[model samples]
Target: MKSQCKSVVTIIVGAMFLFAGMGFCQEGSEGKGGSAEWTKVIDSKVSEKIGDKGLVNFEEGYIEAVGIGAPPEQFYGKPQARPMALRAAQVDAYRNLLETVQGVQIDSATTVKDFVVESDVINAKVSGLVKGAAVMNKTYLSDGTVEVTVRMPLSGLAKAVIPQAIADDKKTDMKEHKPVPFSKKPAPADEVYTGLVIDARGFQARPAISPKIFDENGAEVYGTLIVKREYAIQQGISGYARDLTSAQSNPRVTDNPITVKAISAEGVGKTDFKISNEDAKNIRAAKQNLTFLQKCRVMIVLD
Candidate 1:
């Protein structure tokens, strides 16, 4: 009887050990599975934050940028660290975009003091424009860093800068004028065009609220009032391209295309260009078919 009791006790102890070991193995497997799933989720989030290059959408005039941030000492062990870091990253991204758009070069002869003053003004304008920027993506990394991406639409940039540009133009002595109405003569029987394309390559062209196309004699052939104010506010002054395909990609393509060339550009504070006489005549002739190019689906190729 004693031997049987001892055998029964030994069996019970061995069974308990086996069950405990099984429970531990199951727990370990579940822990590893959960960790693997979390890693995958993080990777997906990072990929989303770093969107594809095609996200730029140049046709729609959208620009994108990325920024990164990490926890700061002031927020050490605090919940606010993440939020603070994120805000910092966003500000950094905006600065980056400002640098990109503020490519306007100051004159070399300008004194350091003058450059500083001008730079301050430029910085203020850029900051105001960037405030309306859109936040596209945000992510938190395993290393306690935060990443962000911001986008600015050219249309939105135009809306913000156009009014200021117009104001600047007003400060100048350059008077706003209207395009000469084409002689109300009958159209040439052979004339056919879809829209205007300016070969502005090899010349410096910049965005303007009231871009003008001038003749060789410095006479304005097209000016601000010619383009609808609503259109400028919506579509911007002009769409730029490096080639015909890029030009057509713009939302402003037309069927009857009239092409021109920019011979030279003037003005340091603003961009003004003169077209060749041949191109000027083409523009004048185009005025006869103004209905097609009314929105100035004009494309200026740049170097």
Candidate 2:
């Protein structure tokens, strides 16, 4: 009887250990699985900050799009005829109209401006009279009051009539969410902040001026000139990242942003050239569209 009791106790203890081992294995698998990859992806040097900064963990997020009403053509007709002339005219008219009626109550103003008539062209008849596009201006005051000014084309009166009516109906729906006025003092905690919006679109990053920098051909350059500029991430975004972490964990966010400074082109003659504003704009646009995946990889090194 004594031997049998000891055998039973041994079996019970072995079973408990087996169960515990299985549980630990399951936990280990989970810890090494899917979510672990997210950490690694973020940890890679391309996106990571150097020198013990906090890691960035992304929460599941959603992008919500709020439509500020489509342009008139999309509302009325098919988008098959989006020629540049028409688009240009549309934008020009919209801007002009906004300026003309700056402070009028949108619902109460009932004036009209004339641009070109699309219907005449649509009907295959040439109406020699130049028809201008209608205009409407809306203003919102500091006290959450809204004002509107409208200029309807003679032929557009029909279309114009409905918008003001809709505006009238939706007046109550406008919530009082105006931004707080600018202050000499710091904003209260809950305000959204934006860093200085530099129009660096075409602005190439140049090396900061250094007193003792030299150029190619072994000539001592008096001031620091832009050498080579790799691409750089936005400062505001990286600054936010730096603020998120402290020194306690494996890493924390750093206060400084990573930048790619320009380098000098060795042995190249100083060629002074001027590009047109339009060309500069195009260059900026092109640069903005350049692939950022490579930048992400480079940032991983910093991480």
lDDT of 2 by residue, 1-303 (tens): 345333333443343333321211221132221222434544431222112211122111100000011225433344433222233333333232322322111121222111112122311111111112221232223332222221222222222322222333235322321111122343333422211111111222111101111222232211111111221211111111111122111121222211221132221211111223332222223221112211211111111
In model 2, the worst 10-residue window by lDDT is: 59-68
lDDT of 1 at 161: 52
Q: Could you tell me how far off, in angstroms, the CA of residue 131 lies in candidate 1 after the best superposition?
A: 4.1
Residue 48 alpha-carbon offset, candidate 1, angstroms: 25
Model 2: runs farther than 4 Å from truth?
1-26, 30-46, 50-53, 57-280, 283-303
TM for every model, in the order presented, reads 0.59, 0.14
Cα RMSD for candidates in order: 20.9, 32.5
- For 1-303, candidate 1 gives per-residue lDDT tens digits of 345333333543343333321211121132211112323433322111123221222233655555566768877668988666666655555544444333322211221123224444533444455554565666666666665555666565556455545444445425543355654554576776656666655654443334666777665655453455566677766666656656655446565466666788755633566787666666666445555445656665554
The CA-based lDDT of model 1 is what? Answer: 0.50
Best by TM-score: 1
State the displacement of the C-alpha of residue 53, model 2, in Å, after optimal TM-score superposition: 6.1
